[model samples]
Target chain A: MKKLMNVPNDVVDEMIEGYAAAYPQYVRICAENKRSVVSSKPVRPGKVGIVIGGGSGHEPAFMGLIGPGFADGAPVGNVFASPPPDPVLQVTKAVNGGAGVLYMYGNYAGDCMNFDMAAELAGMEGIRVETVLVTDDVASASKEEAHRRRGIAGGFLVFKAAGAAADKGYALDDVVRVAQKANASIRTMGVALSPCYVPQTGKPSFMLGDDEMEIGLGIHGEPGVKRGKLGTADEVADSLLSTITADMPLAAGDRVAVIVNGLGSTSQMELFIVFRRVARLLADLGVEIHRSFVGEFVTSLEMGGCSVSVMKLDDELAEMVDHPADTPLYVQK
Target chain B: MKKLMNVPNDVVDEMIEGYAAAYPQYVRICAENKRSVVSSKPVRPGKVGIVIGGGSGHEPAFMGLIGPGFADGAPVGNVFASPPPDPVLQVTKAVNGGAGVLYMYGNYAGDCMNFDMAAELAGMEGIRVETVLVTDDVASASKEEAHRRRGIAGGFLVFKAAGAAADKGYALDDVVRVAQKANASIRTMGVALSPCYVPQTGKPSFMLGDDEMEIGLGIHGEPGVKRGKLGTADEVADSLLSTITADMPLAAGDRVAVIVNGLGSTSQMELFIVFRRVARLLADLGVEIHRSFVGEFVTSLEMGGCSVSVMKLDDELAEMVDHPADTPLYVQK
Candidate 1:
């Protein structure tokens, strides 16, 4: 209830308005669909349009990534809630060039249903649209049930690959192929030390004992694999990496991109500490880190935790990962 | 305290080790000075070197800014503590090209004393060193005693201007002048809703009632001017902007760069809400926003609060702000 909001009910609208005002050069709210945020820079005609969407609490994730060499548009939703089909369709229509549009988002039931409906609506208008569900959270499912895993920070890598491939003028189908491939290669797991509050409800999405931590919690406070006493950064990193690598099985010579992402309230200082342990563990396992990112990328609302994600990279994915991107929240060159 | 640290006493060293590991591409620990982090990329000959240092908790500040077109070296200290003179001297020696070196840090007593000592030591070794203390926290002192005000997030602007000026091969005196000018043109203020715990202390820096907020709180949990019931984001933004503009009045034709920085725990969604109001207030006053930065730049561990910084821009400062620079945390082109 200590959030800096105007009214609990208006959090999403005010946030979107503020975001548009702050980054006028990078994005603008769609005139026809107030919930849709589209890049100010028009999408090139031949490039595949990348449309990303999800709930609104996770800043710079779905919307902040809309810019050149990134998502073409994002249909923002209420906090921890899915966007309606209207905004998704509108965003697709706004960003659809000569090529088709791709819908990428986390694997959530509400999100999947809404986006699917939007895709159907887009298809009725003769626009080609594809959907790629990110399911990289290793702790959410066993290897044989990978499709059941929920997406988390690893979606960033998938977005990067998809956006880069689209920027390279890949066909819509090829972009989807690369995105699916990137999705398959990435794995993520998180440890939650505290819970996050939802503005509308004025309550934490979940609760945890002060001395306990939950391993593999979802972005929206979904149940993780286990709850145990809080451990040191090194111990937590080991648990996350063990869970992730067990599912993905990284080899000594394999190259990968790593993300030590804060769940929300965790400090960058702590993330780096976790990253230190993760880097050493990976080195011992013979996995070469092609690039490393440590920060708050995807987050719950003021949750205290961190997640580790690894994207096993091939030459194509490596090139895509290195592709230049400029967005409000993240930038690379 | 529920912190992700191995040992409270080892937090500083572990944080430094993790930072070095995560960003080996940009920096490395100075062999002789374990406390100093010097850029892996050497300073160009005859360029005025920029050396920034402070406590270790503010990740991506003193150290993350060390790279091409930014700080050449950063001597890190323990949590919320100023670094010793030896490491500062070592960093100065390591990055001191033929020209000279600039020592930039917050206007704090311990830092000022230690850096002054470092400059004297560097002088003994025949290295030229100049200092610019950032004093931009309008809430910390009256306008008549602005020089006594504590430095805060506005220091980022001063650093960026100084680094850009030096990178452009400005003479030492010119670089110092520009840095001072940048510092003079910037002002900042913050509000804290909750306290951040120091790892070693295992207690919150300060205390607050559940529904209360402290306006103009310092980054290290220093007391602020007022404590009142938490208000809407717009109301908070109005109070912060009014205080800042009163000290450093802006004209209708003025242009400025604005940063709505989260102290640590504020969600990006809430930050945008604050920024929305900030933009409207500035626009109503006829001040043009040259650029907007909305994220955590300088932070206070996991403090729950935010600071707003405004740098009034003249043509020279505007150009310097627009200059291309890339660091781990910030990149502009």
Candidate 2:
């Protein structure tokens, strides 16, 4: 397809330059690297700083959530691919206060290995660094194997609570624990209508018939748990919600938050249609929903379809969820 | 396409039922009506409640912006169609706090006339009502007649600042003035790659070649001012941003905000690609961007392509832009 770019190779650099230009008040591109950070200068004098790194495509996922009460820096990689360790290290060092730094990222193998290496490298520089991984995609594993499920949209909740805790001056381990607590209480299930082509690869991550959808697909285009005929918004919601709820198993009188997220190509109308059904299904089961958001949260390039995320809430989780936050992708008062 | 709906006609209502069912804590639907109010129960007396309405297809557009400090009641209509007069009246009456109601909506003729009539009907019932129309789509009109342009993605700024002002307890007239001022300072330009089908019509709203784009198209599938071969992300941003900047005429050293929005089917990567370029171009022109957002804000169902919105910012606009507000669709703190 014709595009306005100077060339394919310059796409990433130029894109970063543009992002820095548009959001100069909220963020800036590190002059030393392509990583992004809040424009507000990071504070020093011994406070834990949080840094999150990942590929660029899952917006509001990694980059969109960077700001106060969130990440100090977000090093964006190429589309749907992990960033190099160099940028991660750069972000960690830049955001590390006198106390230490903590790194949070998805459970992707490349991300886990690379970020861990970055954290180790930062430690070598006398910067105390720690890491927490989010793994909340219930469809990727059985309940007994929840730890093995691929991380999906639930990472936002982890990021939000953890960022708030960190912002409130929690120590590195406490922030990590709160984030993990949020992660443990959440689960996600997703379906894909079409495959998203990686720019570097110039090919779809996967393929399905026009009349079908792949359920339980990873954001990286990995195969889903099931490939079935395309269903209505209600059925899609039922299928995804049932999988998420069944995997989580919330009983009556439980309060939860729902996120009906579009992968990429689905419209908000389509997402709302799904939300309409999911809301009804939850109500019929006597579940109380505290907060609800429907949009493209963790998208897979231009892949069609959506994922449902339900975070079973308790008083602590509810308080953390309702806490004030400021981020490019989402915010709450 | 097969959907999870009980029936196509029941889709919108079912979705409303689902929304009310799920977000009972944050919002509640009016009895037997399509309107919803943020559950800050026992709204302070004499508070000027903001009411916004539009067809529901825009996802977070009118409805998504409903929440504390933004809109009190969002009366959603059908897919890409205006809410009928009854819901408009009910929503206005339901959210009116003895203070008076400020009706905010896009500048579509049907919506304007319907909402105007509703205001009159509500006024007849001794409820004070005022209306402010948002007209920020610069691409649809020549500079000489810019006020005639339709409201596109730029309407978000109006919803945001107005909601913030109303939450601060502005009177109905002042709230309308703030929204109008924001709308006046903003201009948007959108291009469509593919037309989306309205389920009610069961057909494409418009058509285009794979290599073409329709610039300045209305949200309801209205024709744009120009249609041409599809361009690169940079080229699209150049055309859209240049038109927006020129229409608003930003001075050197002036600060502004940019919103690069996807028209549904476009990828977030594509929007970012465009955002990167637009930011660079604006920087080159000596404009300082204070804030920026990239996502699917106002969409045309599943249409491909994106829109660029620029709001020339001053202290008031900037403060309002930075004010704390929350809604299902957009948020700021």
Using TM-score as the measure, the top candidate is 1
Colliding pairs, model 1: none
Off by over 4 Å in 1: none
lDDT per residue as tens, model 1, B93-146: 999897999999999999999999999999999999999999999988889998
Which one wins on lDDT?
A: 1
lDDT of 2 by residue, A228-320 (tens): 988777778888888887778988799998888778777766676788878778879999888887777787777778889999888877877
Q: Candidate 2: which docking quality band?
A: medium
Considering just chain B, what TM-score does every model have?
0.98, 0.94
What TM value does chain A in model 1 reach?
0.98
